[model samples]
Target: MLLDLLKLHLCEACSMTELHEAVALGDYDLVAEILRTGRCDPNHKDVDWHDRTPLHWAAAKGRSELVKLLVDHGAQHCLRSDVGWTPAHFAAESGRLGVLRTLHSLHAAMDAADLFGDTPKRLAEIYGHQDCSRFLETAEVESRSYRRTAAMKGIPLDQRDEDWEVKKEELERNPPYSRENHTSSAQKKKGKKRGKQ
Candidate 1:
């Protein structure tokens, strides 16, 4: 495995090493040790694959405890992957109701959309995750009042306005499950567009 990882020329953030595997495996003790010893970043992303933080894997895998631990340390629920799939999106798609509940309580953006412009609720419905879809629907109805005034409000707690562009670049640099060259070209095009504007 080490040789394979070395041959892949993957960055530390890539899903080529111990940290990413341990998280995916839901090895709680290993995850805790890795984070506690500062051997791995709690927010490390597999830019090459899932374009997700460890928390996303945990949430999607229905490892609620791991998800909580990851969040308690540091994980941004609002951050989008290459395809704009957030951890919330994955949880909903997988029918991980408990994970969805945890994310909702954490104030994960209930209305955030993916690259296809499908929100988690929309995906849940499309995928026949009835219970998860219902949860999102209920939350939407309950939060309607807040949603009305939220557009005019300042940045919510999880997202940083100043960090968006940097985040975008980072996302492009390590797109979810994309070849490096492919993302590099995309990044260049985006960079050029930014320059033009």
Candidate 2:
């Protein structure tokens, strides 16, 4: 029974990436060690958690230090989850002002909107994070200014997640549930009911 239990534990452990686990557990030392050894990709998304990366977890957990570590290790802060929620979104939702500040300092896209067209600032407002919302009000303007300056200077910014964009495009093209689809299905149901009557 002990051997079986050990095997089960090992399998469960193997299912979650060490980097994600370390970040989630808030084990700074273990996370640092894992990054140093390059044991896992910092940007690896957790499929079981709506495609959230370690950075997302760190931001949500209000771990500004971990956010820095992940970004330094080449984590893309622009990466979005299944719903297009970036690390900034998570931080804003959880009122992690420090994480937002950390992300802004690193030139993350704080003004990025999710699939629902809600930016981090909007999320902060929605979640009643007045402090975060106030900060983001200025941050969003600065973010846009920085982008424009970079464009004028011909400085390339690594802010876009091309893979996510492509996936988003695919979802838009073949959405499982859209307004038109829902309306058509509703009409079909009504027609069936009328025929029965």
Candidate 3:
């Protein structure tokens, strides 16, 4: 009851143009309406204000719905602020573990470091958010493992790695390099025997 009343009260005082405010205040209705109507660019950074994007605010405040909505509307998940801090940095400092997970799922930069050389996970540990810290540590390890394997396989580190492998197998079934060779040694041997017979 109090939260709804607060939202109503906050929305009343906010300008329709301030998408950042809407995200910070957890006003999903306003955000959805704006995105649906194309009233604003979801990826736009606030130049005159804090220089952060709507996704940044949503992540900082632990607003999962807003973060998901912003990303769905084509927000740049890995965009950095003036201080080189990304949305992940904000989420970690505040112990927003679920927000961190959501950002990672959206392919946000988990390894981005701020001007002080502190990554989101490092900041989480420094700020005493143990769960967020541990989560990021695990995520980092998994990401490194995946990247190393992808490198060894000589494939791009993209979400389409599995699809790439399948496509490669399909291509290898009729490899162009072997196609120009005319025939294999087995075929040559069979031709010689047939000719002799």
- Most lDDT-accurate candidate: 2
Give per-candidate clash totals.
Answer: 0, 0, 0
* By TM-score: ranked, best first: 2, 1, 3
| Model 3, position 182: C-alpha lDDT score | 54
- Residue 33 lDDT (model 1): 76
**Candidate 3 deviant stretches above 4 angstroms:** 1-17, 145-197
**Tens digit of per-residue lDDT, candidate 3, span 1-197:** 67655654554353333677778789999989878766566655665544577888898899988998988887777566654667888898788999999987766657766544678888787667899999999877766676677679996532332333454466567555655555533235346767998
TM-score (all chains, Cα) for each model: 0.69, 0.82, 0.65
lDDT (CA) per prediction: 0.69, 0.85, 0.71
Query: What TM-score does candidate 2 reach?
Result: 0.82
Query: Per-residue lDDT for 41-129 in model 2, tens only?
Result: 78877778888899999999999999999999989998998879899999998899999999999998889987657799987877679
List residue ranges in candidate 1 displaced over 4 A: 1-17, 141-156, 160-197
